[model samples]
Target: MNNSLTNRLGELAKLFFKMGVISFGGPAAHIAMMEDEVVKRRQWLTSEHFLDLIGATNLIPGPSSTEMAIHVGYIYAGWVGLIVAGASFILPAALITGGFAWVYVTYGTLPQVAPLLYGIKPAVLAVILNALWRLGKKAVKTSKLLVIALGVAALVLLLNVNEAIALLIGGLLGMFWLHFPAKRNSPEDNTNLLIAGLTTGATLKATAAVGASAATASAANVSLWQLGLFFLKIGSILFGGGYVLVAFLQGGLVEEYGWLTQQQLLDAIAIGQFTPGPVLSTATFIGYIIAGVPGAIVATVGIFLPSFFFVAALNPLVPRLRASKWTAAFLDAVNVSSVALMAVVTLQLGAATLLVAKAPYVDFVALAIALLSAVLAIRFNINAAWLVLGGALIGWLFFTLGLYPIK
Candidate 1:
């Protein structure tokens, strides 16, 4: 490479690496930092073009912040910058989470650590609930979209349908129901159309769910290749943000394969929130638990690989994508469905974290932590990372003082 090109790539690497280390609070915070450094400070791209990139990332699947990093790198340093920027941004979080995974695997069962996790897990639910509320307001704009969200929720929450399948059903149904001109003159006709659409989608979800159930294998003998493939599929189809990932993991890992217990999944999410950069770093923690260092490596690469491909492919089509109504309709449906799925996962996690199997049947302290966390997050607009840390500190203090009993 020329000296100028090499220098530019190096600059890209340094900037993104720094952001990766400090970019906490999830995708929104990550993007705000990028905007400041890349646009306001560095003058790397104009605000208009940066907004276009954001829209493009939304059009495609993957973490929007990570994709934005890749997009900026591509603009500044070409294909190599794409790799460098993405890896730079991901490396810090992956490494940090990997270290935590090692510690968790080694000492998670100890009394001291258990209480810390006790608080963090419920706080994670609050975080996910916050994301669900924010995304739901934006995605569910129309009554038709509301019907779509409810339908997708029913499929996943009640029928035990696969999340990916439910998402596809929602998107396709939305494209047809929202985009196409229908001959519905009255409220009765509109209601009938929505009912028919939900019925058709449910039928499809049921059929897919049956096949999906039969195909799931136990993860007791999971191979690295299988692990990589699972995450790759997740990366390709994941919409909304990192919070949406719980739906996919809850179904595939916890229920289908039994690779992780509900508690383990909640712990993984808490670790992800505790770290910086993309929340998908939870993959690194999860991979380590399932298969050690090799698993962590494969899982991280597999889950992040799709984002690079998506950003590259979608970057060129941003203008066209932003103009198409059909694309907008499809994205709206998929987004609402993703939010709906997140809502279901949040409820499930709440039950897992706030309710005990014996005696009291409820952990009132955990419930109080969750309520406080939610108020701080929604009403007070506190950062999620702070809430997580606050929960950890409170749990540790409560346990140390003999106030909160250890389960």
Candidate 2:
């Protein structure tokens, strides 16, 4: 690579590493951070290019922000740059989260941190809603696309279908709809052409089924090698984003391996959500809880190694991947599916905090503050960090005024 390119790559790595350490909240927040750094701050790519990367990553089966980082790295430099960028972006959060995981596992629970997250969770909900509004406007360009998104959301929430499956089905619908126009007289011909094309191409791949089965099999046969392999497979095959990882992790580690109890798994997830970086950092927590530091290393590596490999392997083919009309259509469908899935996750989280969980009633003042923050986010385009800070202040108010218990 050229000297200039090398320097740029190094700079990207350093910046992303810093982001990985401190960029908490979840994928939405991570994406916002990436946009701020790479697009607005760095001016490495135009806003349009950044949005395209987001759409592309949403279509693929991995962490969207991480893949975006890889895409930016590749765009700025080359293949080596991609590696350096992804590693730099991922490592900080991995290490910091791993350390926190170690502490949590070793100590039994994170009582103080829990309240911080309790406050954070409500903000997370608002953040997600704002993202949904923005992404929905951008992604659902046609009526058919909106229908596909709604249908996918219903199927997932009502039928309890696997998210991967929903994504594939949406993609296939998009592909077919995009590529093959229905006869003019056909009843479905009224559907938006682009949405139809995208969904048709998004049909689930046979490989995905095979990959999931292998993961299950590996988890069933418990060995250190098997454990690593199971998570490796999960990380490799998992698409959508961090919430998807939660389902896979709970199933593989808690249900399949019995490595940790459901409560412990929930706690790990809670910590990951509250802390910075990707939810996959929960792996570090799981690793430490299961077998201490070494296990943490193995699990952390096992989970992320797949993302590294998949992005690297796919980098060469990205052009071709984008070229296929069917593939593009499928990606369109997948984006809808991903957003639909996020909607479900958002609702579930809201239900947990508002209804199912044993949290205190929402203080009207706090809710009003949160609503105002959400309005600012939607109307004035405020940053999430500012909103989160605002929420924290409101939380402090509640605590000080004896409106809510500190715990």
| Predicted model with the maximum TM-score | 2
RMSD of each: 8.7, 5.8
Over 1-407, each residue of candidate 1 has an lDDT whose tens digit, in order, gives 99999999999999999878767556655665576578656889876567556544544567888998999999999999999999999999999899899888998841235767767776766766765664566667889989998999999889987665677778778877888855533564354445334433543443333213334555567888889988888886676565568888898899888889899999898888768789999999999999999999999999999899877866665544334565556656766776676567667777878899897899999999999988997788666557767888888999989997866
Please report the candidate that would top lDDT against the real structure: 1
Clashing pairs for model 1 are: none
- How far does residue 363 in candidate 2 sit from its true spot (Å)? 4.7
Model 2 segments beyond 4 Å from truth? 1-3, 32-61, 181-227, 239-266, 324-326, 347-366, 375-381
Model 1: residues with Cα > 4 Å off, grouped in runs: 1-85, 100-112, 182-303, 315-319
Q: Which ten residues in a row have the lowest lDDT in candidate 2?
A: 198-207
Clashing residue pairs in all predictions, respectively, total: 0, 26
Alpha-carbon error at 172 in model 1, in Å? 0.9
